[model samples]
Target: MESGVKKLKKGEREFAITAGVFFVGLIIFLLAGWTVLPRLSYAEKVQPVEFRHAFHGEDVGITCDTCHFFYKDGSWAGIPKMEICVDCHVYLLGQSPEEKKFVHEYVLKNRHVKWGLYFRQPECVSFSHSSHVRMAKVACETCHGPQGLSKKPTEYRTNRITKYSFVVYGAEAPSNNYGGLKKEKSVWGTIRMDECADCHRSRGKSTACFLCHK
Candidate 1:
């Protein structure tokens, strides 16, 4: 009986040691996570031109539609061509180095700025900007976030799992109960099919798959 009692104590000590080690390891993992994990998860790329929408929209009073125009055939403009820039930037408008580079390289050469688009829906999806913009009168900020107020170009984050630009998910807030952008300031950061379904259902719009998918 004494030997059995001793073995029981030994087993308990071993178990306690194992539990303590595991707890310590977990704490270490969590501590390292604060700094290390984010770097591992995110990929970064620098944009060629550091464009400021705030300078254009807020300061210059340029509207979103001025640059992202919609066509008569219902397609929304992607990127403004060099000709559009030449209309205003034929001469150096600002003393900024970027403006000078823009005038010298792109404007003078009549070359288009290769702006990288953040939201690139899958080929199966066919989004209509005209229907959303003209008919529904949805503001550009609803989906694109407050990019108009953004002072600097932000580095786009791409989710490794979804393979979609994190901007699509991160840019827009979650749907409010009344079918508009979230006002409570929560960034759930994903525009999934379910989110779209919820928005459509809230607005009493048809949630037909064919409406989104080609």
Candidate 2:
């Protein structure tokens, strides 16, 4: 009877250990789900034209201002027109499938590719590229992330809840935070009104509604 009781207690202890481990694993799984599941709600829109920014920015050394320029009147020339792409892609530059696709669809047809803008702001909001880039000397990568080194075309993902591009919430997000690469959270990294407020607060600038709203 003593031996049987000892064996039963040992089995109970083993069961308790297994249950403890399972609960711990379950807690970690739930936390990970909470952090990552929200991002899956984004509707992914593939770009019609697959242009490599790294090919232009890194390999060819084309700067952001080369295509994205600011007028003297402070108006931002955000996306480059087909004329800019046509300069180099006038003829098939390579035997790659992407090049052929671009040449056949856009260049040959003379139809402008409707490239989706990832960081598009609302009409009511007034954002000055000149104010950020030329005046403040802010790096393009600061807002746009490391597009300069991107080998693939942009994946335009829009959050269903916000109807805004996922890029607006800082392109390299939860991954950056989880990897210990970024100390600040995505809420602070995003280029939303809150992000602007934080920057203004840091710089001692005003956060009046009229300052951003037009």
Candidate 3:
């Protein structure tokens, strides 16, 4: 009976040690999230427009290059001219209201819809899109989310300011919240520099100041 009691005590001690280690790890993870994850920088979606990428990419078989603009260098064509819309919508004029809206309201007037650009680098960064798309054979969705899955007339919102990235190394806030960008007097969304750094890091590449800031 004494031996059995000792065994029970040993098991309890091992469990306590394991539990303590797990608690420590959880605490560290929470700290890292508080420090590393970028909080929303004053984001408000004007209209709840959602797109399902899988349906367009897998089911309908739409090529991304058809809509997005790519450059010859490694830089991205952030926004394409309305002519690109005309090329496709010129035919869909009477077919659907969705198509007609692009052709008549925006394209005909040569006006660009202020689509909130989600994947954006600061004006300082000089990454070329052509080299990556043409030479590297990268797909448009690699950086930008597929839009076909997104609802028509994608509403755009942006921070009135730039948020500091987490790599600011030893910064107080894990992420800098851009108060809001009221540039055009529109709604604001949470796309920030922290997102850019996170996307670059996920690809195992870092676009530090020396590399991209030109």
Instruction: Note the Cα lDDT for every prediction shown.
Output: 0.67, 0.70, 0.50
In model 3, the runs with Cα more than 4 Å from the true position are 1-61, 91-95, 130-142, 145-148, 151-157, 163-208
Error of 1 at 191 (Å): 3.8
Which window of ten consecutive residues has the lowest lDDT sum in model 1? 173-182
lDDT of 2 by residue, 1-214 (tens): 7656455567899998999999999999887777666556666677887778777887778777788887889998888988988888899888779989998889889999898777777788898788777777778766676666556565656667776664322343332122211243232123567667887788777788887899
Give the per-residue Cα lDDT of candidate 3 at 141.
41
Candidate 2 residues lying further than 4 Å off, grouped into runs, are 1-40, 168-190
lDDT of 2 at 156: 53
Question: Which stretch of 10 consecutive residues in model 2 shows the poorest summed lDDT?
Answer: 173-182
Instruction: Report backbone clashes per prediction.
Output: 0, 0, 14
Is 1 or 3 the stronger prediction by lDDT?
A: 1
Best by lDDT: 2
lDDT tens readout by residue for model 3, 13-126: 999899999999999988766654424442334322222334445665766566555556445556555576567555543545544665666667677666544556667766
The prediction achieving the highest TM-score against the true structure is 1
TM-score of 3: 0.47
- TM-score of each prediction: 0.77, 0.72, 0.47
Residue 139, model 3, lDDT: 60
State the lDDT at 49 in candidate 3.
23
| Per-residue C-alpha lDDT of model 1 across residues 110-149, encoded as one tens digit per residue | 7778776666677888888888889998777666655655
Please give the lDDT score at residue 155 for candidate 2.
63
